[model samples]
Target: MSKARDFILDIFMPTRCPCCEGFIKWDKLLCEECERALEPVDNSNEVPPAGCSAAVSAFKYDGAAKQGIYALKDGWGISFAVYTAPLLAEKLKGCGADLITCVPMAKRKANERGYNQAEVIAKELSKLMGIPYDGGLLTRRTTSMAQHDLETASERAEFAKTLYGIADGHSDITGKKLLLADDIHTTGATLSECAGRLLSMGASDIIAVTLCRTVKEK
Candidate 1:
């Protein structure tokens, strides 16, 4: 019944590939060409940010992956979350997370955007992975400059520290293992800052996951 409904809807409101904006099957997230262009991340070389026990990402922040992320952020392709969650869920198999959470967006920014992309992905992931999700695990302290605007890693890290705090009534996560979700991983600064807050609140461990990550130049 749902598939029939989706097919009917596709006739009028066809699902476009998030990366290329080309018409695609109602059930597909990316066109074939865009899917082929994705570069998977090498998890063996991934280094978790301080306070996080592990970090995993599905693809390099380039090509189709970059466009897909941008699409989600700009509110054009929310279905990106439905496509990405399963991949991250596979990576997180055996990661014993008691709760799933996400990097918080400032209230002002969330209001303007009408949704937090990170939270959207996290909730989808929680449903797919069978984990409890807590959207209120953290809160943004201020509306700071966007992380992409920071050029250097040091600058990004410093600015991120001032952005997040444990959400009210979530002070004691005692012994809970958490999985943190976000749309992208650049310098890992924002995830690190959030993980630190969770650790300080007594979380036993944190595993961070993202849809894509910037590949550092050697």
Candidate 2:
């Protein structure tokens, strides 16, 4: 179970990078060069509210990171999750969360994709962080139009209401510090909507983390 053994095993198992499609080193989920290329989102200045003290993101949703996320989302490349989760975990240490919850896809998309990429990342991070993951605390009631295609923030947030946590009686989120994971954040509308829902559920704390955030154009 040495890192080198794992890397060799991974190569033989063919878990290559989705972007370059090259063999990834075992000790690193992705080649070190690629990791260095990713630009992490700096959230040091934003003063988040009580429940949402702050958020961290490992990369701007551009360049290699964008390519990696696209490959995973469009091509069903699961291997990308393996490498990306650690970067997220590193940003998340000491964030203070009791449980991990991911931004869920609408049932329609879930049925189509056969998986939720965010959920996959959250599960992987939960394992790495040794924290329990709560997959059922939220559920997407409906699918919204693709945010990328939309041009306005209001349109995006309006589209986001279709997503709602299934808060009937599955579990109580009250007083729990929750971490919400997503693949990308554009205008923060999507994350804000989900955070709003968590707050309504009486979630004591919420942290919005994403693998990447779409860099706004000037």
Report, for every candidate in turn, its global Cα lDDT versus the true structure.
0.87, 0.75
**Which candidate number would show the highest TM-score if scored against the true structure?**
1
Segments in model 1 whose C-alpha atoms lie over 4 Å from true places? 1-5
Residues 14-108 of candidate 2: C-alpha lDDT, one tens digit per residue: 55666555666555456666767777677675334234657767777787788789878974566667777887788788877999988878777
Candidate 1 lDDT over residue span 84-186, tens digit each: 7888899889888999999999888888888999998899889888999988778996555788898998999999988888788874579999999999888
Report the Cα lDDT for residue 16, model 2: 63
Candidate 2 residue 85 Cα shift, in angstroms, is: 1.7
Q: Ten residues in a row with the worst lDDT in model 2?
A: 45-54
Scored by Cα lDDT, where does model 1 land? Answer: 0.87
TM-score of each: 0.93, 0.82
State the local distance difference test value for candidate 2: 0.75
Best by lDDT: 1
State the number of backbone clashes in model 2.
1
